[model samples]
Target: MPDARTTAFDIDLYHIDAAYLAWKSGYNAPSAFELFTRGTPFRGGYMLTAGLEPAAEFIGNFRFTREQLAWLRTIKPYEDEFFEMLGAFRFTGDVYAMAEGEIAFAHQPLLRVEASFVQGMLLEAGLLRALGIGTLIATKSARIRTTVGNCSYADFGFRRAHEPIWATRSAYIGGTDSTSYVEAAHRFNIPSSGTIPHAIVQAYPDELTAFREIARLMPKYMLLLDTYDVDQGIDNAITAAKEEAANGSGHTLMAVRIDSGDLAAWARLVKSRLVTAGMGDVKVLVSGDLDEFKAQDLLATGAPIDGFGVGGNLAVGLGSIESDYIGGVIGAVYKLSWIDLPGDDDDRMKIAGSKSTWPGKKAVYRFGDFDHDLVTLDHELAPDGGRPLLHPWMKEGTLLHSHPSLTEIRERAMSNLAAMPTWLKALAPEQDYDVRFSDELVALRDRIVAEHK
Candidate 1:
């Protein structure tokens, strides 16, 4: 792999080719692009907007390095002038986006870019990647949080994540209390959480030894059960906790993790044993292929599960078969909305079948407790008591304000979720949200369609 320090070449080759062609033709006029998805993921009513920080970072750092330019030269015989243009390329754009952790709906522009045509085209791939994965994981995490309800949840999906750092950050934005990925924890300032793995128990000689040693070494630690036998593991954990208390080590047993077999039944058994031993304060955290649906089912069983450690389902975007949530991709697309030329500004859109896009620069206005949203031309007036979801984040490629801390973003997410109607927050939301276009927007679309025809 190439050095990770430089992000110059983190773009599709077609964008470069198109930009080169545009440079040759002198067609780099002012343009606008909007990033949006047509539907919600997870069969849910809404999506949590995330990744704006990373996307803004990408735009701010847009530039070509000498090494990257040299590497590009070897790919094909390109003119030196084109390379010089690339070396001097910068994203002198204006960006409008929803704040990280805000709730969004279908057809809303999560992000909008206004820049030169070449600059906007070059941003497509990276913007999609950042916003897509970040939003997907955040939405999934929000659903999990809803199901778990007041329970401490940790992201334990580093091994299953396509990109561990991004997954960890997105999970935190969507309401996870902590993450198991140490690098992400340190980098993003997220709380790190985990329990002793099965390997640790095997490495020690026996499960009991592992539990005892970990309890002795750490002030607070979670013991991993089911390394050998679930019953024996529980007994060992209890003994270790009791010994730690008697020895006055000041150590405390935080929780016990059960990673195998019928988790609900095992959680019940573990909780029962802990209560009987007068260690009822010991929390129960369960893992192993846990998803929102499974977590909901487990909680419904009246099991005394104190927390959840979700892995693949939380990080990998594997749509729940039970909930019929679409997975694998968030389906966010960046499309041209308008272009400005000499003495003429033209609204643009794709007219292809179901892929047709709305024309012109737009703004989404929410009315009456998010009861409905209206998409209208950017120049349109907002109705009384309306709130605009998108706000200026960047001007001429510079941030307008400092990015919010992760804790702030997580709190915003929880607040947004709390304000949503109950039906929309349901595990399987079947009702369609009212997202309509203004009368003027509809007229413009019709006129544009007629002109195309």
Candidate 2:
């Protein structure tokens, strides 16, 4: 345990201050409760469950450093005995979750963790942090991917997301063809795509010379064609490409990117120009502030762009979103849903206004052809045709399954989404997909409510 341990993102350290304060106030709860809800209102009908492996990794390796324990003694509330207890903390729990790429509906628990109340409580924040950002990016990425059909796009949102690495990974799983983050490229083995910035074109004595030099070094690179003048850059690139072909070099690229201005109109212009300039094989790529909404709009109007580079809209999702019918940052959360005790089994729930959650250890099951979903109690088996959604990810504190590769995950997303109704796929759909409560689940809710009343 180096000091760097605190610098990283782990619930043990990330929630250390909160955990200490809770201990001081005797803020111990006997059971974990689901404030009973899930889903981002503005993000449409469903979310993609992601970051489970990373979340599991954190819980498995979490530890409190000596310095952390020593500092705890100085923090106002935590007792020495508490620090002693902290010295032996480990997350011994059972976790069930929707697979990483699974589509989740509202009020369905995407993940459930059964640990002692305190341990589970401390995990809420970090788990939410991971799933919130990961799911948001994945959902956002999926929108862009589904909107474009076969047209390609890259996750160029690294510069925009709060967690650059995680966001890129989420976007990849969400469905981007590639990323501009070089480190993530190797880490995930995804294609890394980038090209000369406007700065390179601006610095050159002539755009042609810059392209020529770059082509010599990286012959397959896509050229940035809007730095000086979109048309001029294209002309220079044509001359450079001819030169490369003559010399048996720089012969691979068939595309140039336009980063600014009216992208839809520009995409059409670039396509026409590339065809007339004797480089008809060359394609047009557009980058800038693009999202699924904007891309969807462009495709609707028949933009001739070959690819899109989505940045801010994909990277930095609703940063502080807090509504169901409206939009902003994703509203993903984590909560304890069930607890087992000697001679007793309880399903805990919160009835807080506007934040109420379904009570119990619950499981989600999907209905016909991905049209609707049912949220049911975990113990009460649904004998109906509903297919169980949550699978065992961890048991006895050990990871029980291997995650699919990014490629496979993306394929799952594409395959499943294809079955989704067209109306539900709309950018801002007029109607939400149906998410029903099982009869048993509803009956349990009624019984619990009657008891309180």
Candidate 3:
């Protein structure tokens, strides 16, 4: 008889530990782990390394509550040893990974964890969940960063994101300079930025009063124009900038944001109005359904828009490039490459069907000139027989890594964007990069197939 209790694992990489607990406790992980386990040697060439921090956090805290264990015991015949194992579930695995902010391509051993088979196995659910979701957002945001060029962008997807932490961290990693989420800013030290919502503009008797109240509170606040009348909103915003300047508050109306209508046209019109009103230096910002293509289209006009407030499409993503949106997708797979049990001469591999994993661990190298378009081998071997992709992010539960400020990450992302190849940078027809495994890995793969047969 089939055990209907078993379900699939449907999470990003970092959420694997949580997925394990959830699966054991009668909640479903994302995809079918049974199927995943069957494919011990995955077919894919590389995986996007992501979500290691969150996955590590989940693994370090993975434990079954006594209540949960007791409930499990009540269900059916249970082994005392198995119950004890559950009680003491801790991931003492060591993970080698690329630094979180580093740019990575499709197929490279992004993360490598070494631990007892069970320990590593149990962490899969949570790890995949965290990594998958984050990478998706980061990849999507990278494209927007490309199209928008030097213009600044902010995260405003707090209300729509699956979790607040996800919203905050995802936006941060996805290349947004600041966020509208106050709690995210407080927790992660990410800067909190916002003008007023359209509701605030509509709440007052007139747009001028609403603008006045906001400008008074934070004199240099970014003003949102287009609650009802967009043209009038610009006029009102100009009036507010003038008043703020005359009051000798030293508060300059920093920027005015246009949310709807033909953004390029409206931005130009608003810029003209501000210049006419002697507030020529005041910046114009734009939002509402912003994506990479739209950002490029608006930028092409050379509008006076200073930056953007990217919400839905950027924070989550537009859609998949080659795979599905949900499920344990990203086609990001972890494969068992070596089996060395003490007495073995060297590492061994197991190959079956389209599943043939390279053995003896791996490293990646960039083979091209980074100065020109920054093209890289998807995963090139370093002559030293070591993997270059996995750099030290953390060591022994200590955050040995020093993450740069959000401003810094934004600047670095911009630099990377400028250097990326035109063909690979577009968010369409997922660019196919090259990754080559060493002869030793190929030999190991061949041996596995022979032994299994």
Best by TM-score: 1
lDDT of 1 by residue, 157-264 (tens): 999999778888999999899998999899889999888878889998877888889889999888989989888989999999999889999999989999989998
Which portions of model 3 show Cα errors greater than 4 Å?
Answer: 1-50, 320-329, 341-360, 368-387, 392-419, 429-431, 446-453
For model 3, residues 60-85, the per-residue Cα lDDT tens digits are 55666777668666753556766786
Which segments of candidate 2 are over 4 A away from where they belong? 1-37, 41-43, 318-328, 340-345
Off by over 4 Å in 1: 1-4, 321-324, 343-345
- Which ten residues in a row are the worst by lDDT in model 2? 1-10
In terms of lDDT, which candidate is strongest? 1
Q: What are the clash counts of all predictions, listed in order? A: 0, 7, 32
In TM-score terms, candidate 1 sits at 0.95
What's the lDDT for candidate 1?
A: 0.88
Q: Is candidate 1 or candidate 2 better by lDDT?
A: 1
Select the stronger candidate by TM-score from 2 and 3. Answer: 2
